[model samples]
Target chain A: MIPIVSDLAPLVCGLLLAVTGAGKLFGRRTAQLAANTVLVRVLNDGRRAGLALRAVGAAELAVAAALLAVPGTLLPGVATAVLGAGFTGYLGYARATAPESSCGCSAKAEGPIGVRSFARAGLVLLGGAAAATATDPWWTEAARRPGWSAAFAVAAALLLCAVSADLDHVWLLPLRRLRIRLFGNPLAGAADGPVPVAASVELLEQSVAWQAASPIVRSALLDHWDDEGWRVLRFAGVYEQAARGARPVNVLFALDLGASIDTTSSPAVRVSVIDDDTDEMVPVDLLAGMATRQVLPMAT
Target chain B: MSHRQNDPGRRGLDRRRFLTTAALGGATIVGASALGGLDADAAFAAPMPSLDPAISRSAFAEGRITQIKGSVLEVAGSHGDQHLIQLTNATSIWKLRTTTADQIQVGDGLYARGVDMPDGTIAADAVWVNIVNLYCTVKGIAKDRLHLAHGAQDHAVVGHIVADTTTASYLGGALTSDLSRVRIGQSAQILGAWRPADDAIDIARVTVGH
Candidate 1:
């Protein structure tokens, strides 16, 4: 039973390596990963990085093929151990030096290096070491005793899937979604009432006043406040027509909440340019004539 | 806030339904009002144009240049898709600056946005070479480089400051090529060209302060 379990480790690792290697070799993402990630910096240049990735991929495929076909070969087991160790070391280096870099272990796996990546690498290393002690191939051992061997293989694969953060969408996310559906999403009732600031901001963005003032506005959403039944949204803008040449001013839009009207369609939104230098409000009628224009002019 | 606001019940209608109805009705009212002096009959009779959903509006592609044959560039996408990009006189190619087409090299990461041609080639109007805009936090500062934590995951990023190109914008102010003011733990937005194959980026501009 010990030998059978040990042999099964190499089999699982071999399959995992084969998938990962195939992704590196044939997948379109390999080029980007090689070029954009830390591989280039560590490996010297882009061309070298590409070559290195391909070589690793090729080596992995060869080892996987050897392990799967030869079965009881000690050479493949030793090679697997070395490869796993190398992966662990490299991942560690990447994590410490370039945490922003993607692992590039698999095609679909594109995220910053994290603990799960470290775990996955460590798992491979452990599997390789365990396989080195096996007397016979897992398949042959399983053929002799079917029940426990099958169970071990299934358990090992499931464990690998669980540790692989890249494969989470496959098994984990769906389970989470189902659970949410049954129990209801916790955030569903978070927003009860009283118009959110985001909603107010969205309404401001869609307003005609915003369109007219956007060109002069240099800064985004400087400050916002509610005053006299109106939500005032302020932005930093250049007041070009100032007496003392062009100067920065606070552009405020007063949207009436009392009207209970969609500000997007409402023509009553008032605009004011406040000069900080003099503390004076300059009312602007930039969008005054816009309301009388033709509406819903062909969707094209 | 009043309980009436909390209850979300207005004029005997549910909150969601009321909001939806008000939005739609307001839009209709606005449209009618925008018709100038046009009568209601003319406003209702106006023809509404149909939008074609099948139209492909894909204007951006990011990947490495695999093959460059004449004015055509064969790009291998980050995903398992291949893209052919055509360069014209109007197509502006930028590496670190406003450069010509000759600067574009194979194995260089790029982002091109333009009209997708009928023959599946993208007629690129603009191509930014190795450009990356990152919202990062200053984790540490060294003599030569600044260690940054970028994205929601706080991924480590090394930013190399170019003497000529690297500039800083403080508190929505004008850009200045001074690094002395930059401090640790400050959140910064950096625009720079990514060094191919490296986790490091050459900083062009750093904007600090919200």
Candidate 2:
């Protein structure tokens, strides 16, 4: 069993690596993130990035196919090991330079795209290739070895399909559940008491054009809430309309009023009063339409 | 490990010389005979199919053409898994049920049985192309070939128009006169079969060209 698994493991690793390569070529977000690592950043432009990924994917698939088709040969085993070592070298380089930087691998999800994973994949491939080359003869006592090898290869191919999709979320869900169980709350930072009333608010869409009027006006807007004893939150919402443009295209800024706000409902307005201890919309003396456009900074 | 490091030549002479002598003796014996068994094995290096073609043929006969997409045919049987058979200028053509190579098209389902080629593909002798109708647009046109792009990934189907049946109706529009008559931006709904190969589409239709 050990020999069988050892002989088959590299083939399995090669198959998985090929799938990963294909996924990267197809612009999978995870695959893209992986490519975005510092080493890949050396390649300029998105087109080049895609081409590099496709070339790598094709090479990986070819190697895997070769390993399977031409077994009992020392040449393929050595070739696979060389490829693995090259991958490991790249991983090491990435670790040395950008240890904390996000791995912009094509996968949209954030995960540890670290050197360890690459080293693991490489070593597995090398081991399998070596074992396959040095396996027992055809007339060994285990007459069923050939059948078993064929079966394992088929299984590896099927698994390769799943790996290609980058849908390993199914496998990682249990890990997430365990982490959540160990940790009391995942989101401790945002769990503060009732949010303070915003110092000032503006229609974010119009704020852009309004800010262009003067740099001073923009600076004033950013600084106004800092002077006031209130915290501001930038809110954004999307709404579905029965008829197009029926929804109100406006945002209301409530001053320092301790108020309840519904974060979930889109297109629903929440009322808050500045410097007031109630949920009511407090009246303010207008400094023209610009005062209404004044926005409070969250840091303040 | 230390033995090899210390005195490798002694062991090498024993194993290597003995094997070489045995191989030479076997080669001489087979070289001197008309039956020509073991020498042929040394020369060939790889095992060919069994001497009895009937046994190999019987094993190959079990695969059915599971799906067709353009020039690529998918055969599933004896192998117990779908194997893609790529057809090109070099592929030997065959007919279904001993009929001449007619009645073949994209989407024509088939059951093909043949010998497993040394390269691990089936060399089908009998191909039963299943005929199924497909509606797609002319994604691209190359000389005598039309490329139909379809489905989520927008797979491309490439094929030349069947002789004489050149006119085709596109997207519920009137049938155009011929493949040449259809414009680049025109939509086409073709009644034909599709054969799926590796990332390819093979279309065979009775009516095309819109």
Candidate 3:
């Protein structure tokens, strides 16, 4: 997973740092721009928030550009990593003590950029520093075989690593976009992309099991049931069909059997849509028996 | 605190996340310090490890080829360190500690271990090539025909000529043929890379998502 993130880290960090640096070098409106975002509302006053935000953005943008341009040689990597370490440390300290904050850096960006928003940038800077500073074993290889053949082989290997890193982002994301454009995915924009019942049934429900994953994943699963769409009606420990043909509505939040509903009495769930004319409780069991499934993809 | 008093979102960035990132970054720098030096002038070179028969023989363990398909071969053994090994048929197999066959096929991704046979022949013992998993992107597709773009280092990937029943969609359209279904945009976690001969790759399994 870390390696996977590393692939995108360079691109995102480089872009962020370059943009941030440019903002600082040029004008103060970057802060003003951040202040206008809804996500930044969590920070209280947008104008004042904008100041810190602008500094951060400018710093990040510079780091990002440096990361890409700087070859992962020993000296350059160490230098860049040092800068990254210091910057991230400062961000960490600020976050730790601050009362409440929005990651004004990407407050306006779409969908799940985790604390990685900062850490990934930091890692790339550091990793690049490490790669740059570390000695290429090829030198030794060539030393053993004093010929152009040895030289060519080492050159090819180094070139491969560099090119792979450069193309990382487009390799995954652009191709996805291209596939979508050329093929026209019917499942486009659907929650979890039209999951088949067989696949959805495989969702791991045990809390202990789920908690083994990264904290970010666990927290997302716990807090955002609205976005998760599918709810756990009842864990019941084992997969028992309430009825053979009854298709359960895949929801994220599980309902406690006796606490939320009477097993024998009252229809399982009561759905009441508030409209101008009607307000009534629809039986949960009735919907559970319905065959068509509705789900919302969990997006943070 | 001053920034916090004015902009509350600044407070939301957790210290834990920041510290973890910072510490990791710091560690990477510290670690790189010990990994030797890289001279930029000599950056482009292939790393040729010094091969000492005595020491190197100990590093490679004996295993048997349990299965063979294409570019992928499966070998089973208790060797703990090596989880996956990728090799071609042109690999020299003559150290007579183990020998299963005189020559493995082109489609065979073999697993064999023996002393570097003086005659370049690994003696009779064990040989295995375990089926491997490849994560790749579908570069092009035809019904039962798939072209994949995969590989790191050399970017060597295989194209699988198999069609899966799962309806894969990319962008906005529903693909009809295997060719139509696979667009240049989607990525897949493929199971096998069946290289019958030459540089061709045949995919075994294609997994997009659950």
Candidate 4:
């Protein structure tokens, strides 16, 4: 069992390398994808990143071919080990410098570097180490024990898919989708719950009242409370006094809570300006010709 | 927030009607056509008024909240500046939904528009917290959530789908509340608000099929 598994390690690693290298070498989005990786920063040029990506891909393919064609040779295994070590170091640098950048190891993987990436790199290292000690080729082992070899290959393929974000849409997402369909979604009740505060803000921003008072109003919401059925939004503002300059004020907006973005109901909004010094309600009539006062000649 | 009224079409006329009707009244609470003329592109920040520019600058503050002191938030601006944001009962706090000031936490990013008080404190009017515009891929889908994969600092973001609030634009078509068109593995740009408590996002709009 141990000997056969050891022999199979090189074959499995070679297949992964072949797939990953092909994506880097032949994928139409290679250059675009490389730009999203740490390679662009490491190489110090966008164009150089693409070149580096292709070079790594070529190295992977060569190692893969060597592992497959000459598995018993110590030289191929040593070369695979060297490549694996380099990959591990590169992944570490990528994780540290650009924690959010994609591994770009597989070229197909766009997901950020995580535990799975380190594990994949480790697998390559281990596989290469095992391949170095392998006496019989993977083909010979498979021919000698066909059923065991086939089952092992399938299991290895599934494990590879589990770690590969590029293949998530194929199996993992479907499984998750199936689970969500069967057991019900985790986020189902949230939508049916209360309307978000943003909806109210959106409704307020659209109202004619908001348009009228916006010129006087300044600042984002300072605080708000539920007064009866209305949501009151407050902001900092200044009342323009023509040549007298602007007086610091607080803008208050009372919007009907029943209104929401989903509903077709027209948002009814009321505005008030308070004198910061006097604490008196500044009449809205002062700003009569504000943005909302325009009389459109073409109105129905 | 764009109000480019270049068209003389029906939509433009309706916008003008919405703007003109009850625009500036004594009561300042204009109803009727004020609410009636709103289309899909509801007046977000209608044509910028010819109001004083200095007043606009003094009334607005933007940056990350470095400290939360009671109802007052200490903000460190994007530039080299600091501000004290004062929140009161009249202030509307929007995280993803219209929420209270208590929903706001330290380190949350915000855009504040308010009165620049004599004491240098900004009496906030509207506060938007953690407003995020993310270009992501729908890695997985649930009944009420879209598992988004973004490239920025947050790689995997759980995007909550609000029933009535979350709208989808498919193949550059009309926006609809039907999220069924959002497929697994499709790339999308989601406009949302972040939840600091759970690190998830409440999606406002998801643009897909591009």
Candidate 5:
């Protein structure tokens, strides 16, 4: 029983390493990861980071091969333990010094080193230590007890997936989504309604008034105030009339909260141009005339 | 406030009437006309352009800085295009703070809005270095690092908290450097600098809670 459990440990560890190594060797994101990996950055130059990543991949594959292919050798087990320890140290270093660097443990994984990363490394180390006590290889043990081997393998793979942050979207996210759907989201009523500030901003951006004045608008939501039945949004603008000498102006849009404007509809928002210095409103007719003569013609 | 004197053939005259009336005292009357004017081209003669694409505006370029020669910068865009940005005395360079032209470095991401010269170079008016604003989920947290997941595809990103620059805003609270209250599994909005070579960021501000 002890020998079988010990033998299974190395098999699991070996499989995990093999998958990781494969990703580093031939993943589409390898170049991007290698270029940013703290381990590679600290040890190698810009051009050499790629070569270093490939070397690490090769080393991982070699360890995996020795653990799986070899019958009952303590050497493979010892090597695995050392490699796992090295990974742990590297992750710790990365977390401390280059906190923004990628772990580079998997092809699809671009996350920073976290607690799960440390746990995964520790698991590998423990597996390697268990393998050192085995008298037979996992394959031999599996042949003797096929049913137990299959169950154990399935359990081990599931555990590995649980520990891997990269694989979370496949299992964890679906489970979370299901739980949320069943129990309901805690943040569902955070804003109390569907019409958030972001939604209002989106509505404002989609308005015809925004389209007409976007070229001159210099700021994003400089000031927003709810007045009576309307939401007044302001932005800094430059009055481009040569007579005004490119003077600063305030562009205000009063959006009616009661009116539901569709995307296909013409905007039902009122636009006003206020003189910055005089604090006087520019005549809407004059600005509309200017927009028709200058802005709307440029649109076509 | 009346459009009685204006010709009905004139475009946007009804819109002006509604706006002028709305500004005065007749809010309900303005609302009725505004709703009716929804499909009227005469109300809004200018068409609203589609705003779905993430394309940068004209005279603006967003990319990674590949090379720098004096006041000139060679940028490689995310989309297979290259831009030559020329810095002038008038150009305002901003990283985490307002900085000078000499602070720009290779392997740094950049967003430059400027004038496109006849010779194809952009004479920059404003240059934002490595600026990235992301809404992300805090997947994991360490002593120094925060593992962030961003975008609809859940792209993993690493965010580093700088000592002086990094501040946190909790529940729409004041920005403070004391981030001991930050927890794991919360959604956060990060304003930071994107490291050019990798999928990492140096966070300037992190706003958590709704």
Candidate 6:
């Protein structure tokens, strides 16, 4: 089993290299994908970074072709090993220098250079080393032990797929969808929990009462309390009267406690302003006479 | 205190209805209000001898909540500053909605606007928690989510698309639910509830070509 596995290792390595090489050279949105890599940081130019990716792709393709055409050959195996080592070193550099950069190990823009990247590169290096020790080509070994060789190939393919983020849609998302279908989402409780305070603020902000009183309101909600069943929201505001330039005042907005974000019903909101020093209500006549400032986007 | 009935059927009812419809259609109400009005046309533009200094001296406290001992929050700012924010019944706490002080979890980012008290504490009137304004590159677009590479530091985030709630603003245009114009590699501004769970954002608005 060990002998057959070693003999077939080169073929697996060739398959991986071919896919990645082809992707790097001809992948959709290649420039955008390359920009996500450390190559852009290294080269300091978008076009140059793309060129560098293509160059690397060419090298991988050459090595892949050699491995495929001359299976079990020591030269191809050693070349594959060298390429793997270079990849590992480059990944380590990329990780340390630009921690946020995608591995760019494959043509796909995988999030960041993580453990999986190093492991995959290490696998290639080890596989190459093992392939170099094989006396027979992969086809010859498969012919001798057909079932074992087929199983080994399938296992290698599964292992590669496990570490490949680009192929996640092919298997991982499906498996995740199945899990969600069988057992409800873990975040359902939090999502279905009581309405958050932000929603109330959203609702209040949308109200015409808020729009009219907003000019005088200065700060975010300073305090809030329940009056009867109504939610009373308070704020620190400056009421600029005709005579008093900017009198520091308290603004209160009252709305139903059960008010939610719904287009069907427009809940009544009451807004009031009180003078801080005089402890008197700011004249509603003044509030009523204030001009409405236009919302810019709405004008467009 | 004073208030007038918000009669939608008053004179200029069409304009009022237009404003209401426009506000409802846009998902960026939180963000737009958060930005605040510049060059505000004061309700009464006039001169006064005694311009109250308290109105001009609004204390602002922004940072992560290091400690939450009941209503008073101990916050550590990014600039090594510490602040004590006091929440009251009138003080509104908003985290994805208007909520109570109990919803404010420790380690959550906070911005408090209030009056400064003599005890070196702020009497917070409004508090917004875990609100994020992120500039991102659209890496992948799914039916239910957007894979984004956010900020210069390159944090990968998942932006969830809530039906009827999430909106898109295109080229400085009006906000709409039609997100067909959103494509991969577009630069966008995401204003939403950035939660710690799964590093995801319940996106309220995505503004592209801004």
Q: Score chain B of each candidate by TM-score.
A: 0.66, 0.33, 0.33, 0.63, 0.63, 0.68
Tens digit of per-residue lDDT, candidate 1, span A1-300: 278767777788789889988878777767767775679889788878877887888888998887787767677878888888898898888888987777776655456877777788888778777777778877788888889888888998888788775565478656655654676543233222344333454455555655555544543344445554666555545566546676645566666543322333554556666654453555455555455542566776
Name the lDDT of candidate 6: 0.69
lDDT of 5 by residue, A40-142 (tens): 6586675577767777788888889988998478988888888889889988888999886777776565556777788888887888888777788888899
For model 3, residues B117-165, the per-residue Cα lDDT tens digits are: 4543343122332234556666554434455656431133545443332
Off by over 4 Å in 3: A1-16, A23-29, A36-45, A57-79, A86-112, A115-119, A124-174, A177-300, B1-210
Name the lDDT value of residue B57 in candidate 3.
Answer: 44
lDDT of 4 by residue, A164-196 (tens): 766776898788778767876554444344444
* lDDT (tens digit, per residue) of candidate 3 on A1-300: 232223333433454456545654455455545543332544678675666566655555555655555433344445456656765664465466542232333323211223544654455455555434433332342355456534444553443333232343545446555766777753333233333221221222222112111111100111111112332211101112346332211112222222211112112221111111121111223233223322334588
Off by over 4 Å in 5: A25-32, A107-109, A143-148, A185-194, A197-218, A240-247, A260-264, A287-300, B1-210
Order the numbered candidates by lDDT, best leading.
Answer: 4, 6, 5, 1, 2, 3
lDDT for A137 in candidate 4 is 93
Which regions of candidate 2 are displaced past 4 Å? A21-53, A97-120, A124-165, A173-192, A197-257, A260-300, B1-210
In model 2, what lDDT does residue A92 have? Answer: 66
TM-scores for the candidates: 0.54, 0.33, 0.24, 0.70, 0.58, 0.63
What is the alpha-carbon lDDT for the whole of candidate 4?
Answer: 0.71
Give the C-alpha miss distance for residue A36 in model 5, angstroms.
Answer: 2.5
lDDT, candidate 3, at B36? 18
The reply for model 4, stretches above 4 Å from the true place, is: A26-50, A241-245, A261-264, A286-300, B1-130, B141-146, B151-155, B158-210
lDDT winner, 1 or 3: 1
- Looking at model 5, residue B103 earns an lDDT score of 78
The RMSD of every model to the true structure, in order and in angstroms, is 18.5, 38.2, 30.2, 9.5, 12.6, 11.1
Residue lDDT tens for model 2, A1-300: 366655665556555555555555564553345454564566656556556656666666676666666655565566676666766665667667765433333223333445435645555456545645646422231355878887766865555433332343344334444554576322223223333221012121122222212211100111111113322321111122335422111112222322221231111122211211121222322223445544555574
Question: Under CAPRI classification, how is model 5 graded?
Answer: incorrect
TM-score of chain A of 6: 0.87
True contacts kept of 1: 0.02
Summarize candidate 6's per-residue lDDT along A1-300 as a digit string, tens digits: 278867898899988999898888887656777788898888899889888888888888988898888887798888889989999998999988986687777876667777889998998898888777777888898899999999999999999999876676688656755655566543233233333333455567666566666657666655455444566666667777677687767666666666655421364666666665564666654235334444456444
